[model samples]
Target chain A: MRLLREAAVIAGKDLRIEARSRVTTNQVLPFGGLVIVLFAMALDADRPTLTRVAPGLFWVTILLAASLAAARSAAVEIENGAADGLRMSSLDGASIFLGKAAAVAVQLVGLELVLGVAVVALYDVEVRSSPVMIVGALCATVGLAAAGTLFAALASGLRARETVLPLLLLPVLAPVLLGGTRAWEAGFEGTPSDGWPWVQLLALFGLVYGSLGVLAYGSLLEES
Target chain B: MLAGVDLDVVEGEIVLLSGPNGAGKTSLLRLLSGLLALTSGEANVLGHDLAVDRRSVRTQLALLGHDTFCYDDLSVVDNLRFAARAVGRSKHAAVEAADRAVERVGLARQAHLEHRRLSAGQKRRLSLGTALVRDARLLLLDEPHAGLDPEGRDVLDALVRDAASDGRTVVFSSHELDRARGLAGREVRIVAGEAHGGRFPTAAAASPTTSTSGSGSVSSAADEPVAGVSAARAGVDTEMAPGDAHEVSP
Candidate 1:
C-alpha cells in the first residue's frame, strides 16, 4: 500500500507536468493523427484496402506514439539532473518505474482514444466487441509502457539516447504490437471469442513486463 | 577515481571538503551520499553500511549539487512538495515542510512561478530550499555558493548554520576558502583523490568524533589548517559529467 502510494505520487507529478506542458495535445497527438492521415493517403484511395489494414495501422500509430511518450517520460526525469535528486531521495526505484509506466500508459490511452476515432472515421472500419477492444487496449498499453519505461531507464544517460532508445525498445515491443493488432483484428471481424485469446496474450505480456520492471528497475536505475 | 581515502564525521558536525576541480571533491561527496558506489572501499554512513544499505544512507542525507534538481514544468511549491512526498514525508508533513522551506529560503514571493521562469539566483535559492525541506541528518552541498548573489549566499549560510546547530552533519565543497573556513568545524583537503584532515578553532562549538580507516589518515589540531590548504582554485574534470560532477564509480 505504501509503495503504491509512492508510485501514485510519482505518477501525479508526471501527469501534472504533462497537463501543464500539453506535449501530448500539441505534439504527440498531432503526430499520431498525422501518421494515420499519411497512412490513409499512402495506401492510395482504395477504401477496402484501407479498411482491411486499419487495425494494423492503428496499432502502428499507437506503437509510434507510445515510443515518443516513453521518451518524453524519461526526458522528464533527467531534465535538470532531477534523477540525481531521485537517486539520492528515499523513493524506491520500483516505485519510479511503476509510476512512470503508469503515466505513459495513461498518455497512451488518451492517444488511443483519439486515434481510434480517427481510424474509424478515416478508414471506415467497423468494430465488433467493445469490451474486447477496450480490454486489449488496456493490456497492450500496460505492456508497452512497462517495457518502454524499463528501456528508457537503460537509455536515459547514454549518449545518442534519441536514436538508441527506440532501437532498444522497438524490438522488445514487437510482441505487444503483434498481440494488439491481432486482438483488434478479431474485434473488427466481429469475433469476440477469437479476440479473447489475443487479449489474454496481451495481458500475459503486460504481466511479464510489469513484473520484470518491478524487479529490475532498481538495479537498472542504479546502473544508469 | 577516489583512491583509498576514508573519512568519517559524527552527528551534527560541519566539515568543509576543499579541493581543486578534478581532484575528486565532488566524487567523494557523491560516494558518501551513495549516488556513486565506492569502487573498492568500506564506508559506513549514519550506521548503514554503504555496500549493503545505500537506500538508508540516501534517506538520511541530502545532497545539493550543481544541478538544482527542480522540474522545469512545475511551480516552486510543487517541486518542493513533490520532493518532500518523495522522501517519504506524510502528505500533510510534505506540504508543511515545503511551505516552511519556501519561507525560509525567501522564495515565498515566487512560490507560484514555474521553476524555469525563475532567475538563476532564485533557482539557487529554490535548490537551497529543497535541502531545507528534507529532515536529513546529513547535508551534502557541492559548491553551494557558486553563482549566488550576496543574498542567495546569505540564505545558504543560514541554512547550513541552522542545520549544524540542530545537530545535522554537513559536508560542502567550495572554491572560496575564506567564506567556507568560517563555517566548517573541521576541514578535509582532497589532493589527487586522497583526503588530509585539519581542525578549526571553533571545533569546540560542536563535538566531531572522527576516525580514519583504509589508506586515509586523520591529523587533528585546533587552529591548524590542513596541510597544503589554500584558497580553492576553480577547476574542472573532463572525465566526469557536470551533472554528476563527482560520480566516479565503476
Candidate 2:
C-alpha cells in the first residue's frame, strides 16, 4: 500500500511536470507524426506497400518516440538536481521505477493514439481486429516503457546521455518492436487469429521488462 | 577519492565542513546522505548501517546540494509538496508541511510562481524549504549559502540554528568561514580527503577536542587562524552530555 502511494506520487509529479511543459505533446508528438509522414513519403505512390508496412511503420515511430519521451523524463530529474531529491526521498526504488514506467507508458499511449490515426489516414489501412490491436498496443507500451525507463536511468548522469540512450535502449527493445509489429500485422489481417500468440509474446515481454525494472532500479539508482 | 578519514558528529550539533575545492567535503557529505557508496568502510548513520541499510538512512535524512532540486515547470509550492510526499508524508501532512515550509522560508508570496521563474535566491530558499519540509533527522547541505542575499542568508542561519536547537543534526559544507564558524559547534577541515578536527570558540566551547577516531592529535596548524584545536586532548572530553559529542569511526 505504501509502495503504491509512493508510486502514485511519483507518477503524479512526473505527469504534472510533463503537462505543464507539454514536451511530449508539443515536441515528441509532432516528431512522431513527422516520422509517419516521412515513412509515407519514402514509400511514395505505393499505397498497397504502405498498407502492408503500416504496422511496422507505426511501431517504429512509437519506438523512436518512446526513446525521446524517456530521455525527456530523465532529463527533468536532472534539471535543478531533482535526481538528488529523488534519491534522498523516502520512496523506495521499486516505487520510483513503477512510477516512471507508468508515466512513460501514459506518454506513449498518447503518442500511439496520434500515430495510430495518422497511420490509418495515410496508409489507408483497415483495422479488422480492434481488440487484438488494443491488447497488443497495451502490452507493447508497457514493455517499451519499462525498458525505456530502465535504459534512461542507465544512461542518466553520463555526459553523452542523449546520444547514449537510444543506443542502449533500442537493442534491448528489439523484442518489443518485433512482437508489437507482428501482433499488429495479425490484427490488420482479415482473420486476425495468429495475432494472439504475438500478443502473448508482447505481454510476456512487458512482464519481463517490468519485473526487471522493479528489481534493478534500486541498484541502478545507486550508480553515481 | 577520500582515504583514511575518520570523523564523528553528534546529534543536534552543527558541524561545519570547511576545505578548499577538491577536498572531498562534498563527497563526504554525499556518503553520509547515502547518495555515494563507500568503497570499503563501515558507516552507521542514525542507527542505519550505510552498507546494508542505505534506504533507511536516506529516508531519515535530507540533502540540499549545489542544485536547487526544484522542477522548472512546477510551482514552488508544488515542488515542496512533492518533496514532502516523496519522503512518505501523507497527502494531508505533505500539504501542511509544504505550506508551513514555504512560509518559513518566506516564499509564500512566490509559492504559486513556476520554479523556473524564481530568482536564484528565491530558488535557493525554495530548495531549503523543501529540505525543511522533509523534517528528517539529519540535514546535509552542500554549499547552502551560495546564491542567497543577506536576508536569505540570515533566514538560512536561523533555520539551521533552529533545527539544531530542536535536536536535529546539521552537517553543511561552505567556504564562507565567518558565517559558518559562528553556527557550527565543531569544525572539521578536510585536506586531501583526511579530516582534521577543530573547536569553534564561539559555539560549543565547552567541548574543545576534535571528535574523529584514530587521529590522536591535531596538527600544529590547528593554532592557525581557524578555530581548530589539536586532537591530543580530544578523548579527555568524551564524557560530554548526550548529543554533545558525536564520535564515530569514519
Candidate 3:
C-alpha cells in the first residue's frame, strides 16, 4: 500500500511534466504516425500487404516510439540533477522504479491507441478480436515500459545515451515485439485462441520485467 | 574521500564546514546524505548508523547540493509539493507545506511560475525551500551562500537561523568564512581532506561586532557561546583515518 502511494505520487509528477511539456504528444506521437505512414508509402500503398502486415508495422512503430518515451522519462530526472535528489530521497527505490515504468507505460499505451487506430485506417485492416488486442497491448506495454525505463537509467550516465538507449532497449525488446505482433495478428485473423499463447508470452515478459525492476532498482540506483 | 575528520555537532547547533575545492567536504556531505557508500569506516547521523540504516539517516536529513533539483517543466509550488510528497507527506499536507516553504523563501509572488522561468537566485531559493519542506531533523547544505544575490543570501541566512532556532541541526559548507561565522555556532576548516576545527577568535568578537545579525548566540540552538565549546564537537561527530580515507564515529 505504501509502495503504491509513493509510486502514484511519482507517476503523477512525471505525467504532470508530460502534460506540460507535451514531448510525448508533440514529438513522440507525431513520430509514431510518421513511421506508420512511411511503412505504408514504403509498401507502395499496397493495401493487401499493408493489411496483412499491419500488426508487425504497428508494434514496430510502438517499439521505436517507446524508445523516445523512455528517453523523455529519464531526461526528467537528470535535468537539474533531480536524479541525485531522487536517489537521496527517503522514498523506496522499488517504488521509484514502479512509478517511472508506469509513466512510460502510460505514455506508450496512449501512443499505441492512436497508432492502432492509424494502423486500422491506413492499412485497411479490420479488428476481428478486440479483447485479445487489448490484453496483448497491455502485456507488451508493461514489458516495453519496464525495460525501457530500466535500460534508460542504465545508459543515463553515458554521453551516447540518446543513441545507446534504442540499441540497448530495442534488442532486449525483441521478444515483446514478436509476441505483440503475433497476438495482434491472431486478433486480426479472427482466431482469438491462437493469440492467447502469444498473449501469455507477453504477459510473462511483463511479469519478468516488472519483478526484475522491483528487485534490482534499489541497487541500480545505489550504484548509479 | 575525507581523512582525519574528527568532528562533533550538538543538537540544534549549526556547524559550518569550510575547505578548499575537492577537499572531501562534498564527499562528507554525500556520505551524510546517504548518497555515497561507506568504503571503509562508519559514520552516524541522528542516531542512525550509515552502514546499517542509511535510509533512516536520509529520512532525518535534507541536502541542498550544487543543483537546485527543481524541474524546469513544473511550477515552483509543484516542485516543492513533489518533494514534500516524496518525503511521505499526504497530498493536503504537502500542498500546505509547499505554500509555506515558498512564502518563507520570499518567492510567494512567483509561486505559480515554472521553475525554468525563475532567476538563478530564485531557483536557489526554491531549492532551499525544498530542504525546509522536508521537515528533516538534520539539514545538510553544500556551499549554501555561493552565487546568491545579497537579498537571496539574506533570505537563506534567515531560514538557516530559523531552522537552528527551531532545534533542527544544520551542517553547511561555505567558502564565505566571514559570513559563515555569523550563521554557524562553530566553524571547522578542512585542508587536504583533513578536518581541523578552530575557534572564531571569540563569540563576542565574531558576534555582532564582527558580522551582522543572526550571529552565534541567537542562532546556536546549542545555546552555548561560540567559545563555550568546540563547534565541531557539538552535534555530529566522527574520527577519520588520514591516509586511507577511513571514517569512524563513536
DockQ of each: 0.77, 0.72, 0.59
Residue-level lDDT tens digits of model 2 in A83-185:
8788888778899999999999999998998889889999988888888899989999999999999999999969999999999999888888888888888
Error of 2 at A46 (Å): 1.5
In candidate 3, stretches whose alpha carbon ends up further than 4 angstroms from where it belongs are: B198-250
Determine the C-alpha RMSD for candidate 1 after optimal superposition of all C-alphas.
5.4
Q: What is the lDDT of candidate 3?
A: 0.79
Q: For residues B201-221, could you state the per-residue lDDT of candidate 2 as single tens digits? A: 333433321232222111111
When candidate 3 is compared with the true two-chain complex, its DockQ is 0.59
Mind giving the per-residue lDDT tens digits that candidate 1 earns over B190-228? 766666663333334633233223422222222221111
Off by over 4 Å in 2: B198-250
Model 1, residue B26: displacement in angstroms? Answer: 0.6
**For all the candidates, what are their Cα RMSDs to the real structure?**
5.4, 7.6, 6.6
Looking at model 1, residue B163 earns an lDDT score of 92
**Candidate 2 pairs with clashing backbones:** B10-B246, B198-B228, B218-B231
lDDT of each residue in A1-224, candidate 1, tens digit only: 97799899999999999998899889999999999999999885788899888988999889989889999998988888988888877888889889999999999999999999999899888887788889999999999999989888889879889889989988889888888888888888888888888899999989999999999998887877
Docking class of 1: medium
How good is the docking of model 3, by CAPRI class? medium
